[model samples]
Target: MKSLVLLFATTLLLLSGLKSQESSNISLIPQPVSVARGTGFYQLKDPLIISAPPQNDSVKFVANFLSNRLVNTKGGWVSTEFSESAGKAPIRLQLLPKEDNEIGKEGYHLSVSEENGVLITANTSTGLFYGVQTLLQLLPTAAAGHTVVEGVQWQIPAVTIKDYPRFKWRGMLMDVARHFFTKEQVKQFIDNMATFKFNMLHLHLSDDQAWRVEIKRLPRLTEVGAWRAERTGRWGEFTKPSPDEPKTYGGFYTHDDIKELVKYAAERNVTILPEIDVPGHSLAAIAAYPNLTCTPGTYQVSSGERIMVWDKGTFYALQDNNLCPINERVYSFLDTVFTEIAELFPFQYIHMGGDECYKGFWEKNKQVQAFMKKQGLKDANELQSYFVKRVEKIIQSKGKRLMGWDEILHGGLPPDATVMSWQGMKGGIEAAKQGHQVVMSPNSYAYLDLYQGDPIAEPPTYSMVRLSKAYEFDPMPPGVDSSLILGGQCNLWAERLHTMRHAEYMLWPRALAISESIWSQPAAKNWNSFISKVEHQFNRFDAASINYSRSMYDPIFKAGKDSNDSLQITLSTEIEGLDIFYSFDEMFPDQFYPKYTTPLSVPKGAANLRVVTYRNGKPVGKQIKMPVIELKKRAGIKVKETP
Candidate 1:
């Protein structure tokens, strides 16, 4: 009896000692694992070893092969998939296929164990794809330009992780309808999506401004509407017309182009959701087929005012025009257009932009009023609902679901439709409670066209959406049913943006923050930490020669590092990659001052400090000055005036 007691106690002591050793090894790992694991996931380090049969199925092989190929060897693998001996590696992964699971219905099952091999079973290829993405997070962060090469140096960090996205439809919307982006540009956007693990790209293909995709049945639509006159001016400069009035504008994607884009996106695991704006933002379509309008007329060809064009004789001089009321010809036109679009995009959802259908035209037309009465509609809003329902039925026949802006809920929403909550969170909550899926893209946070920082620092565009507000956007609103939330997207309205560089300036640095918000657990959100990651990404962008705006250094306060000499402090803080020097006293005539040794010292009790920066012994930019004390510290800690 005593011997048995001693044996049991010894076994307990052995178990405890083993656990302690495991804890110490794991302590060497990062805190992110603690957070990820607490959420019930087995987080594995990058360059993970997935043990499989000597020869596995293509899907499993592909999953592991991709991780092995893409995992950043130099940066440390946060996510990876490779085949090798497990006992010697930090993570031992095993891929197991479920026998009873139906094809295309597989999902990831991930967990960690004390056993040598970790089993990860999936029922479909898609499950494996998602698992690869989760593996990416477990890998370490690399400095910009560092590629995950085969062998150099690899670290086996202790981590067990399991993760899956809450929303399956996380997305981003790119409006090619407003101004066409080249096929290469579209693919570039897809590449960016892959970097952030974004799974969907909602392509807004048609709008009032132009028609981007090609329909073999309608050649003239693209040949004409796609190319407008000169582009609009900078943001807010929309009102200004260029002197080069006669210049033409536009481009479109051929059927071949679209097929290629879809294939490209598919390879990156991104589903492209194409949007066709209906009823209201249909001036371009109306122009293509004037007979569809209640007021059929020719468009006065001109530059700069594509947003507002009228039936030549109806509303003369004032410029703005409305979508002519629904007529038989209009429905027929949409039927033909959608028939072709449905064939091209096989996705379950089709975006029928049901927003901002002004009432002026409906009120003005007697025919519309009579049609409304016959259709049992009360007012223009109800008529709009009827229009959406009809389109929804047509789309349903094609085996597709209808998605529209929040305005579709006005008067009445289609029962079979999903709502994109752009106006605010309330619409999403309302839609979800009513048993519909919602994509929350509130303009205040998701509108990328909004400037990223202070107006003075950025270009003279419209006001900017500060970085913090974007970071705070929660796709899943509190009290909102989780099942109803489809996902969210960031919209970059290009009304004022023209060149690709301008597009990059508006997208980058900022989009990085949005990506982290949507993909990373929300609790891990920190603007400062996000800024650091963004800076690292900027280095990658720079090394790739991708055009992007440089992050500005924070201005030094008069009481901070610049306290010695206000003028020198100001210059040092203001300039980037330059040295500053100045002199306050009249002493040392013809004296040479070292960089950062400027003599223009701030006076004691001075309210501001001044500084100038120089490169190669010459002043290239203007001097700057800042206040001595900050008004608020809770707002954010200021970046060091010196970088």
Candidate 2:
């Protein structure tokens, strides 16, 4: 409470006014390229006028959006109207007058002056939309909340900001195949990503779990493949569904829904990249048409039971999910699927997921072996690559390019394929060196589904990617061809994300770092400055009822064994200037508790530890309690005893 209030106070002081036209500390996510703040302010009051050019529907849409936001602000409705012209309008949104502009095509120049009120200009409407986004962030902090508050004033600080994205393909992946998100939910995602100038939304539309896009000719694709039995616990541990069990869960988007979502995203300048995972992760499709796989039989859509088990760092598939590599029918099925997919999505690149394919089934099948020998395919990897290459031709036949996970670089790399690197920077680097266009989404840096904080303090996921790592991500590797590297994205695999609230919690804060990494110049980034901006964004999220993680403030505990084999503990934080206080006896620790200054050995007879974090003598993080045994487990030690 004290920390937020202090942050608010600091924000007020900074936003109130500035001197010498310096870059003031106005916290905007995906920090603008350049900003010069001027003294004084522009007070926005009732009957605010927004002027846009007549017959320019795009400008009108942006203007109306700003008007609505002002009217719906926390303090109450601020009456606003639109007109073709208004003398010195309170707000004006439009494109630049000339073909040659002051900023990039997707860039905008926002000026808030006392004389002219607020004017945002760009080379395109998309740029103007981004400018309005910055303009909204400039409003008084008091107006940041979904609920109404009386006696609040809307004051716009005087500043000029020239902003442009650092890369063209600023994107994020949402795997709705595992857990279907409604059309409205997907639109909400578009709105959130668009706020930070994310241009692409990779919709993972199908996987082993379920298929999430409707095809007109293949009715069973949705009838039998789109749903599964409800699973209540963690992923990969749910009990197997009975053969007759009713598939009461899951959903897919109709053609109309897809069109509506595409329109909604385009209005906000976001493109939808629909993915239909193939060759592998195709249980849903095989469930609909058993003949798609090497072994044809009745197969149910995954109900969260373990399909592949990991042992000794390698996965072993329990069922045959990979599509038949040499089967001609498989290509026909994919051709039909991609034909409708190409018609529905105006975006050029259709993502064909070709990752984590289990090839034992193909290697064992006698017909597959014979076909492989006939084609001169050396191994099962080559066969899978052959399948993707065949699918690539189908995609290109529909006048679309092929994009897939980094695994598509197996036995053969498609000449025109765009690789989305998820394994790590290695695959991305490999592809970039080969002159392929790449989007670096390595799980090590950008997997939003991974735990951002200590596993004990966060929701369940097998892996972790810290916020610092996300901020430190550089889409362009040190030795790669920078031109072939088309920015990057963070992915939120929905296996464990059951609701939009949880998804938002995992995506934001971390996604903000990704946005800055992809949209802001690398030299312009500072960790401390970025954290300050993120803290400020929390209020805006609250105003709009958006969920986010405060995990960065939580103390990260590390346990290690001393020379004597006793447990030694250390505490640190993602954000600087936080003080960690601890108690060994398990009583709730507060600011008065002993502050952590150095590594502390386990105290005699202590059963557990309690800790909390504070800054400026006010609690900023949730109090955490850790049992002594948990500490030993954290240290990867067995047969632990209290030191």
Query: Using TM-score as the measure, which candidate wins?
Result: 2
Q: What lDDT would each prediction earn against the true structure?
A: 0.61, 0.87
Model 2, range 268-328, lDDT digits (tens) per residue?
Answer: 9899999999888999999999999898677999988999987876887999998888778
Off by over 4 Å in 2: 1-25, 74-86, 100-102, 142-148, 640-643
Candidates' TM-scores?
0.69, 0.94
Judged by lDDT against the true structure, how good is candidate 1? 0.61
lDDT tens digits, residue span 484-583, model 1: 8877778877776677778887877566656666655666566655654555556557645567654234223322233332233323342245565433
Q: Which ten-residue region of model 2 has the weakest summed lDDT?
A: 16-25
RMSD of each: 10.6, 4.9
TM-score of 1: 0.69
| Candidate 2 CA-lDDT value | 0.87
